[model samples]
Target: MSDTTQAPAATGSTPASGRPAPRFPLPALIVMACTTFIGIVTETMPAGLLPQIAGGLRVSDGSAGQLVSAYAVGAVLGAIPAVMLTRGARRKPLLCLGLLGFLLANTATALAPDLPVALAVRFVAGAFSGLLWGMLAGYAIRITAPERAGRALAIAMTGIPLALAAGTPLGTWLGTTVGWRWAFAGTALFTAAILAGALIVVPDAPGQHAHTRIPLRKVLRIPGLATILAVVFGWLLAHNLLYTYIAPYLRQEHLDLTPDVALVIFGVAAIGGVWITGTLVDRMLRRLTLASLGLFIVAGVILLAAHGSTPLAILAIILWGLAFGGSATQLQTAAGAATGEHADAAISMVTTAFNLAIFAAGAVGAIIVDGVGAKSLPAVMTILAAVALIGVGFGRRAAFRTGR
Candidate 1:
């Protein structure tokens, strides 16, 4: 398709000689960001309110915890098929449908009468989460100019750190104070507003042409796609290994700290990381990615060597969050750039890899905590971070190319 085919409203088309492109589409981008915020807050708030959820559903805490697991599993299973099936649909309508699906699922979860029913709805919510995530990279790219794709993606993902840092905590507090059901309902209301905003402001884009569409198998064969995905898996695996079990890791260190306090520091630092990445990603994608992974290793080393020093532990957590904050943007941009027209398919793969890492981290981290103990988590994270670093270094010519 020619430049004329790009969505007139959304496209950050290059301006005439000596003229600047239009300003960033902040309103549209914020709508997308809010979608992410709702998805994450819905998925994680259950964790913070597990006690309430358990009592309400008449289930054990262990069983209640599976609400999170069910969601992750659904995401892993949902992204690929959803993206493949919807590849030819109009962008805005498809996004709206995904939002509606997610909203209903979350509402169902809030009203579920038993553990089985809650788990089922949570799974459905996760499936919708996968659908939304699968589209984000391609959506960001489609809505912006090439030079601004990375920055656009960074903005679209702004919801993540905020959701992790503040949204979940606040939702948890609300659930505990009023009831778990209200928490989900509150997010549902927010989702409704975002959906309306998306309908009003987000531009419509035509799906891939029939002649240009390729099968998922071939998309996977695209050069650099696999390497980018490998990096995604390794890098996130290392992060989740520590993140999923952060409380245990903190307790094992015997530092005078709470997980909430540590995570707040991490989340706040992550905001800085996001700003730095958005500023330089278009120019230094490769350099920034490598630096992030390297810093991840350095953070692990600090934790390994610091013993129980509270100050050092807090510092390490900050570094760790900073390393992770831009990860989704960097990796998704690489995948989209690598595949070009197949960006949607490549992004679906990236999404799947990310959720797989989440599942793996929980399962594998448990084994380590049971067998070697939480102290060993950092050592393992360091090793995996090095592996991810090597992947990025080697992938430079293919996936992590130097420029936008």
Candidate 2:
């Protein structure tokens, strides 16, 4: 764990500084990006398809919603363990296996007879997706230059925003038009295609951690790691609190736009946000973090004060997407900066925090939705956004100390 770890040789030549030599391979990056996109689609597409899934399986909406948590529970229970278990395996095979696993999970969900079976298959499948998520950023960064880690992560992560913007809506339509199961079948097909691409394209680099077990203690001891991760946790938690109920909130509040239209607006804005972060994160990391977190706060307030105005609701969601989407890239970049040499370990921890938040966010959102109502989310988001802002303040100070 003391910086002698081997990087994926297929990435580029290693320098004494331990960063990979600059040799950008755009095609490989694209494959990885596509893989990440499908991974996200598998994780999130269910949110918009809940009603269809419930009707198909003869279950309640609440039970169908558990599909989201089932995946997260898999991530929470399986992501770290998957990475650790596959530590000695070559990078390409591990990733390929993970991708292939998604096809099986989604296909099983598509064919599942009952809710319990769907949840079980989804959990097992989630374990695989979690491995992909937990290891992906590190793999993407490792195969590229160190200074461009942010760019590499940004490109790889573009899939996330795109999934939100396009994948879920398409899944909803597929569920609505054809059948709920087809939506999952569509995901299976998508995952298979990406799996084939990954198998063919990604360089067969030896596993970076083959000789170096992630020193959990060492990573935790890294300066400011905790604060940066807190920002990650709080950011996702805040977003999911309301996002988990976005469709209903929009309908009940009479936002004028259909939920589909709203997601389109939000998705497009999110893509813009991630693009901005990718362009600026490497050059202006701290500044970008503060600004995005601030925008998220303003977005929460916009929702609180929307007062049923169509324009305000749209504006609020746009702002939300811009801030939240960018924040994801910014945070992963910070995680890179925080652990410097221990990128994989640091990213794994970040992934754990991220999915754990996703798991918790839905449950917490459900509580709020059932109790105080979706209207209460704006106030709660403001509070969490404020907390994330403070996390950024303390986190930068923590990351700065690592420079010593």
On residues 1-404, what C-alpha lDDT tens digit does candidate 2 reach at each position?
A: 11122234454557778865767867778888788788788888788788888998999998998898888788777876776666667788888888888889999999999999999998897888778887787787778666566777888888888888898888888888999898899889988888888877787666655456656787778887888778789988888777777876876677788877887888899999988887767667777778888998999999989979999988989999998887666777777777765666677778888887776777888898788777788889889989988877765455522121
TM-score of each: 0.95, 0.89
**Candidate 1 residue runs with Cα over 4 Å from true position:** 1-23
Residue range with the least summed lDDT across 10 consecutive positions in model 1: 1-10
Candidate-wise lDDT, in order:
0.86, 0.79
Q: Which candidate is the best by TM-score?
A: 1
Task: Give per-residue CA lDDT, model 1, range 1-404, as digits (tens).
Answer: 11112233445555666566756777888898898888889888988998999999888999999999999989999999999888888889988998999889878887888999988888888899899999977887787766677888898888899899899989988998999999999888888888999999998877777888898999999988889999999999999998889899889889898988887788888877888888767767888899999999999999999799999998899999898898888888788878888898889999999999988998999999999999999999999999989998888667887543
Superposed Cα deviation of residue 9, candidate 1 (Å): 23
Steric overlap count per candidate: 0, 0
